[model samples]
Target: MGRQRTVNDHGFWHSPLLQQCTTEDKTALLYLLTSPVSNVIGAYPLVPRIAAAEVGWSKDQWLQVIERLRAEDLVWFDPERMFVWVRIWWFHNLASQTMGPKLRTRTLENIRRLPEPWLAPFLADYKARLNEEQRELLNTLLAGEFSENDASVPHGYRIDASSNFSLYNNNANAKPNSNVTPTLEAQAQVPVDKSGIPPESHAQVEAAIANAQRKGIVKADTQAIIAAVAKQYQAGRPPRDAGAYTYSIAQNLASVATEPSPPAPPSESELTAWADLCFCWPTDNPSSFIRVDKAGFCEQVTIENGNARHGYMPLGPSKLLVALREGRLRKISAADFEDLAKGSRP
Candidate 1:
């Protein structure tokens, strides 16, 4: 289900930032704020093309709004990733008035999917601005898990600016005051602590990761899969099941085979020459496996599991010298040698 977002009628109209933008700019900003695609944690994938289509703006017009908003420090955009983040997204939503971590997790899922550089700004904003209750919600978002005990978990909201900063729901159209007001609850740290972990669990988890490395898994790529599970464990999300839970996470890594590097594409001259020599190549263009026979006929051959059919063997540029050293081709006529060098055997 899409998350229910609320906008305050009084607060938004009162906002100086909203007042300064042009009619077109304000509409674009509103669209971005209320976009279904935006995650509550604020960072969202949005390109000029998407914004233009969604907000009824031309390409040039949408870009101008981006430049203006960015100048005001209201939004940050990554052209390379086509991702944009709203600077104050969390501050406005702290009035969610909902209980438990589930609400926070909805937004955090999007944040978790972000790279550090993208998530850092929002996190920094939260750190500098959130009150005690809001901080726990932030922690829950970062933790990516729930407390089994509702009593120990905090129900969250921020105080108005007089207390710290003005807390308002930054929605675009909705006006209903929620049945609940976001607030703070005081409680003990509830999840079973690290003491519940078995003594040998750390060793087992490390060994699992090391074994994966030996099998050629890129440590960097799998870091997310590893860090998330570990963070949850440390936060007391599942203490007694530490070994089994983490092992299950690593098991996923074990199942995936390392992807091989893609072969370099053949250049235009090489392709033309190969076509002239009547050699077949991969239509998808990943790699060409070519073979030469004793008859001085050159053709591209496909091999599977280190074996070939019809007496053809694996022979590419890499294997050419090896084939010669192995005496696979002991004699070559002058004409055949010339044809081979020219890649045009008659």
Candidate 2:
């Protein structure tokens, strides 16, 4: 008599398959498969804090299991790099083998039914790379399952590769109505201006400063201190050297608020602005008044005889700029203009 294969009707992994793994390994694997686990295909690094919370284990226990898994080629940890990598291929293979072909087929069919447009490209690419057996399995699974609802072509079927398909369907039936406007009661409560500064204005300034810090225009410590002071002042507790503090914080906050938020890595808009600024202004002995180009590039020019001169200074490559535009640069490090300048090219 052969051992019967276990299958999970839920389509993910099942308890029966988990029985093959040690208790600790099972716990770790289950945590990795749970929601909030990003980067499913490759190595999944788990932070100690997150692992502790997820598995109700101490840091040492979690580390022990992580080490054991790594030794078994189930996981990998790079302490120096601060990442815990899981071998997804091995885990999936173990599950598939235990669960049998039917479970794998059903799981894949469900994945194909996911309506997100962003996932379409990945699915198409994966389908193209599939072996004949895999393709046949997928087709067979899909054949007897529920048929997909036929969606009508939108009025404007401009194939937007960048547009979010999931968002499209969500907003499809939405319509504007006169009664849809928010009532006065629904509006946010404006705090009274007790500090002689309008509460709204103070909030705006604080928000701007936060935004600047987020965009790498300011440091986290600087932002934290400024925010603390602003909050205090807004609540009627002015700091020492109130005027200077207000001015400094306001200036920093305003700088970011004035600029548009950059999108994605290597933002074309910011780069173009930098390029234009480089070509339009003088960079030699640059002054605070020197206007930056749309892409945030400074131009080169000499001010001879106390008059403004302008010429393009060839721009430099900057990883900071890329990080800033990509929204990955941390707020704490971003406030130091010198740090950002280090990555900027002439």
Candidate 3:
């Protein structure tokens, strides 16, 4: 089956914008709405010729329609970048004022894939359109400033495209130019006196960040770290120890950016204990089990009739051990073996 995309039939035909469009303009709008190159975010890569040809319109005819649409604030196109931003696409499709973290993550992922030119404009549009509550929700989800007009933008970063940092462009690859500039982490090194923190505790805050950096646990900037700590103080839940609190907050922020490392392989006896606890004993008639192989790795295996059918990457026994200790691993069943064999989550 072909991939399917959602089109708000009611919203599209009923929109006041459609009333302003000519028949040709409506056709062009429909093409943009259902275009194969378009994505859920409505911002996507496309050359002018491809769009023009898709609708069986001459290049000039398509450009004329596009110009009319742009004049009415219906769509935005960047000729040099070959990208289009279909205005109000989100309003028509996503519809909801509030976005959950998963949807927000998906939206940001699509936005980041656009040519760099689209980043500021896309954010600016959202900032202008969303209400205070919606903006705060997005900001919290982004975990950084989104305003292009903000002073922080001049410090030489865009959104963190690669996930090392959030809205303040912590991704090392987000450098907009070849000229050398301070990175987000470097900017954080400069102390933030405006964080509403007591001057006396400032040194402690810096020390905590430094300590975390020394331990290779901190991946965020100093300002972000201070902001996190300051939030706690404002909430009337000040930590008993300033340094420890700062370190913990920094660790939490770093945890969001850092990918977790695999646990070390456990002893053979430990794996067996985990397997027994989880009821994954070697029954040899379609079941999922955990076992320690000769390579000293604990692998999750699916077997049927005394033959191994599927296997997952061997993991350290730590997670299984904890699950076993807490009686959390559910009893294995035929359904689990099917899920394991199909590479589906159980």
Candidate 4:
């Protein structure tokens, strides 16, 4: 009795298509072709460790081979997330050959008749290489098999071959509003603290500003900090309120200071003044006044001429308050102030 062959055995030995490939290429090709059927998605089955083990190579050696494959366009690797996708040229060639000359001819002919101009070049090139019978079959297949009118083509009919053409046009004609306002709830949830500062977000802003200073990219100042925060808000950072901005600045500053080459430090007077402002004035009580000392303590004071009226204001307890004052907390609008005051205890 003749030996009964399993699909895997048949695919491995008797597949005429596999005969053309070298042993290593054949293994790689089989791995790729089976991957989709094996339910692999995104980067696929060739993770770094698995790829190394499968190929019986060191991690570094496997990486180099992967790089070479990528450079040849035979494989794709996304290093950031460590994923891979492979394209098996041999499989594509095998499939094309298996369709036979007659079917190829019919598919070409029908592609030529497609009303779309983009398909024209492909049809013309195909027809030039194929025999008359093959061309006829190719056209018939394209028209009857892959045609939008074909019930088998899923969704029944497709007038356009490329989905992107309409997508581009739709996007071009779309209008985006430039001045959309946030809803009250969204605004309220945006990290506005009682003192009108954001909570728990000082680190980011400080880091950004400090980075700019260290790189000699920009000078650190109230305006510079605000500008940095504004840029972040525009770029979709959350908690788009004053307090978050203040916290971000502080965070950024601390981060930049940690680098090997720290930027020049602020003068003693400047530091003292900043400490005073952040601690003296309460963000929640914008109406309340404060005084600051060089030693970083706050003294209560009355506001006069929009400034502390009493003797040199003592430094405050809250470092955040000082940073806020340095950040130049703007006077809240009358309506905003009224809202804030209503929430305050008398």
TM-score per model over all chains: 0.38, 0.23, 0.38, 0.20
Q: Which ten residues in a row have the lowest lDDT in candidate 4?
A: 160-169
TM-score for candidate 4: 0.20
In what order do the candidates fall by lDDT, top score first? 3, 1, 2, 4
Clashes of each: 3, 18, 2, 53
Computed on alpha carbons, the lDDT of every model, listed in order, comes to 0.46, 0.40, 0.58, 0.39
Across 226-320, the per-residue lDDT of candidate 1 in tens digits comes to: 56456775676753433334434645534345765544434444444433232323334312334444333345433344433223433333444
Q: What is the overall TM-score of model 3 with all chains considered together? A: 0.38
Q: What is the lDDT of residue 214 in candidate 4?
A: 28
In model 1, which range of ten residues has the least summed lDDT? 157-166
lDDT of 4 at 318: 45
Candidates 2 and 3: which is better by lDDT? 3
Segments of candidate 4 deviating more than 4 angstroms: 1-26, 35-45, 89-346
Q: How do the residues 73-177 of candidate 2 rate in per-residue lDDT, one tens digit apiece?
A: 344455434454343332232322312454565455445444333234333323333455665655565554533322222221111112221111112333322
Candidates 1 and 2 compared: the better one by TM-score is 1
Candidate 4 residue lDDT tens string, 1-346: 3322112454344433233345654555455545432221112434666666666756665565555444323455555445454432222223234238544454344334433432442333233334566556656666644544331332211111111111111123334322332211222334322222122233223323333332333433434355555556556665433333443463454223333443333446765654533222345655554333456454443444554434333333344344554665543334443333344312
Best-to-worst order by TM-score is 3, 1, 2, 4
